[model samples]
Target chain A: MPSAASSQLLDADFPTRLREVAGMVETRLDALLPKPNGHQSVIFEAARYAALGGGKRLRPFLVVETARMLGGSLDEALSVGCALECLHVYSLVHDDLPCMDDDDLRRGKPTVHRAYGDAIAVLAGDALLTRSFGILGEVDLPADVKVKLVTELAMSGGMSGMIGGQVVDITVAEGERDEALITELQAMKTGALIDYAVRAGGYVAGASETELAALSAYARDMGLAFQIQDDILDVTGDAETVGKAVGKDADLGKATFVSILGLEGAQHRAKELGERAKNRLAPWDKAAQTLRDTVDFVLERKH
Target chain B: MPSAASSQLLDADFPTRLREVAGMVETRLDALLPKPNGHQSVIFEAARYAALGGGKRLRPFLVVETARMLGGSLDEALSVGCALECLHVYSLVHDDLPCMDDDDLRRGKPTVHRAYGDAIAVLAGDALLTRSFGILGEVDLPADVKVKLVTELAMSGGMSGMIGGQVVDITVAEGERDEALITELQAMKTGALIDYAVRAGGYVAGASETELAALSAYARDMGLAFQIQDDILDVTGDAETVGKAVGKDADLGKATFVSILGLEGAQHRAKELGERAKNRLAPWDKAAQTLRDTVDFVLERKH
Candidate 1:
């Protein structure tokens, strides 16, 4: 069933492409983040510090790769990628606050709150979140497309999505085992933003309704697979390799896929979801090869 | 020099009009905010608590009155006003957090952090802020106009604006008697959003570039006047009248307009700025009467 383009894409070096997109997004993030130099420079400095230098740039990779797959301009996709990265980084910064996760380390470095204190960390997270939307205003897309992107990001990041999931994560009773709640939480907290990144990539490309639907389904599966893999990693990953403390979720007794489903069961579900995600892209054929590879990478990633 | 329209506006029941707008914006905010009833309903409940039934609604008043004067649709303007109010409420929620201002009361009610705990309070603030932009997407404006509104709001609420000023406010050493720094802080913290409200009103109506410029200058003066008045009230007003603890600024040794300019000097400056603000609206004559009265209201408000 594979066409010439599919064969070419299959032969493509996906990890290399992912790294290249990551580099491009980091540069864009650097350019977009405000330079620190005034009385308020401390906030900007902390925002930059929190946003730059670390992580796999996985969300940005999704954005850029999906857009590129759909024939959108690389540069426009890069801008959106940076915006999503800022949002993801902001969530991390706030989650690390003393009253939140209280984590002191992220990516082998001191967290924003640890490095700059709680007030600046809070402001820096806020500034980055605001700047994410501001970056959309500067993208070279048409007005309607930009508006759609804003709405999508806002919805995904707001109460019904990431923040909703976070509230549940913090408020759920200890040792309470509810598979449905955990599933919904995973879908909302991490999955919503992942879904947004993919859909935004499609939006930037003016992808057809059919294409968008397929992208949505693909992302839904990928997001679940991603979360399960994350749970697996947390159970298996060491602090040095994972770039932050591991086993905290276990220590906190937070419900995760690996908790609800044993490690083998979680891995099985991830594999099944990854296959479904890749199959959803059958229409795109060769252009979807890299995305398919991404699913595999997510299922296999050690950190 | 006052036009007939100006005379009519001047004679208008300014307080009644302000209250009406506040009521309208509150209704819209209620409609826009996510409803509670799920596992994460606590966050929604907290967000609703933070956003509803408090404060003067002065910012919403500015947005509506300005848009109405320029012949924009009332419904559309109300949506924008609600969005601005949500952003405002988000700032208040975060500013009252333990690591921030450590306030126990807001508008005579328990602050969000006090009512919902620090974690939920942070999530509520984040949710409200995100919903603010989501509201903009539903407004009945042209796509480009909506894009402009998003940019305006994002910029006004971000590092170069409100958050920037907030960082400076907390980071500035106690008893730091820098007049210019205080002015910059006031402009960034409060002036930016106020300016956005005015200009967004203009954008909604497709106001001429010249009209927008006039609105900007008027809002700039009005914002400074508003802050000076706030500083004055903090010094002179009681907690019962102010609806929050008063004299906290003095207690904290923070250098406010009252501290830097002295009570009389600050009062004189606010009056001068109010007059200048009113003068900036000379082009609109009677149509701007409500706005002109707003300047007087800002200068005269006890709390």
Candidate 2:
């Protein structure tokens, strides 16, 4: 295991390094994709809206961290992180569209549909979704690892996981829901992609089966905790702070952990889950401590 | 080269075999994907609308045919075909969203957004798009080949190509049209993916560089011809037969080859391109004759 001082250096420099890596990845993403032309104009514009829009670089950070922990270069992990971000942004763009969540704002700005209209927003999401794998496939990685990573991403983001969770969330929003059902929904909708991000990063780093299993468990716990925090924040945080309309979840009668668990209970659960996430990383090198810290930071985040 | 009699056998039985392979491929797709559970109702329903809703199985048929041309098993190619179809369906779903094209119908049925609303539709498209690569990654093929196939698919579908073309198309739609600009758009929007399908199928079969180049050229010509024919069909074909609204190009004032070339000129160009596509395939074994025939069929089709 690396020394505590070295690990501290990783923690201190991680954000700057991550941002630099993200910037490079974004450049590569831009360089690789051809501008949309002809009848596909709206789709292209929408893709740009979704992908170029700003968000936290958490997934990419995981890709880099996991890769570094596994003795892989950051360059190898850059594409994976960028791809994950693309997938994340694509989901947000589509989720905020008129027909799905009907959200008009995200990340402190107009959502893709609000900025570019539904046609372009929809296409933007599609383009981003496809482009995520495109980035991954272009990266110089072992073919088997690449295949595994792509498969994991697809499954996590697809019908059985994220989409599945969204379906349940929407359906339950219109009708009745119980605690069990709501928990299951969050697990699928939010948990799946988060799980994929950590696992994918581990995959790029050549993590062993035990490490992947541990990382997956950590992600699953962290994801649920993160969503719970989000729900809590929706009630307690300012709209300006969170970058979208707050309390909208309550207005829509959306089922959430806070709604069912109550604020206090939700907070408690988040703390417990964060602790569990940290425990999962106990066997990993000290380099992974920041990931554990992120679990706590995510749960306690004000925005 | 194989005898003309072999070519005749391939043509006569190929579609039947292809259909059978499609059925098997569909089953594989069904098995690989998560079932539509109540939680993911939106994603599940939308996926069904886009994927199971009927479209000509043209891309999948091409995959099967190309695999056969290379003396590979159709069963082996079925997953690849299914992946391509998922990608095609994903694009269509997003393309028809209210944000993108504002399309209410597809294939004479309500589009995903119309049927399920926009949010679910968007997620559904995202799900399908991600799932396509997932299917490709998991297919029982060599890892190196899978990597190559994925790279090809991503490049064809991503920025700098399909997405990039879409951007140009949208920008150009807001400006005066030119022949060169229109051709560039067409190449990226349609030609890139079509080229990918042929090249990817060949790559999966371990095709030689010469074979890949020939197939790619053939597909490029066919793709342009196909788009031109589509433009012609938009003007001449009935909406009911075409399954989507016709004359949309005229209504939107979107620039197309037909709009620029005039109807007669577009037809002539399509015919000539179809012949060129067929000629490009001349070096292939007689088994490739069906692909050549399909190009001609695409150009001559009434709808």
TM-score of chain A of each: 0.93, 0.87
lDDT of 1 by residue, B101-202 (tens): 899988778998988899998888888888888888778899999999998899999998999889887888856647888889989999999999999889
lDDT of 2 at A238: 96
Worst 10 residues of 2 chain A by lDDT: A1-10
Error of 1 at B138 (Å): 1.8
Instruction: Provide per-model DockQ scores.
Output: 0.81, 0.54
- Candidate 2's TM-score reads 0.87
> What does candidate 1's lDDT look like per residue over A1-303, in tens digits?
343334323335777888788888888899998788788888888998998887789888998889989999889999998999998999999999999989988877999999999988888888888888889988999999999999999999988899999988888785774778888888899999989988999998999889988998999899999888888889999988876579988887778888889989988898889878888989988778888888878877787
* lDDT of candidate 2 over B261-295, digit per residue (tens): 99999998987887778778778755677797677
TM for every model, in the order presented, reads 0.95, 0.87
lDDT of 2 by residue, A1-303 (tens): 443333223355545665675677677556655565545555655666566645567777777777776777678777788888888887787778666668877866788878876656666676777778877787888889988988888888777877778777766654577778877888888888888878888887788899899988989888888988999999999988776679988898877788889989988898788777777887875667768657756865678
iRMSD for every model: 0.8, 2.7
Task: Itemize residue pairs with steric clashes in candidate 1.
Answer: A6-A286, B5-B286, B6-B286
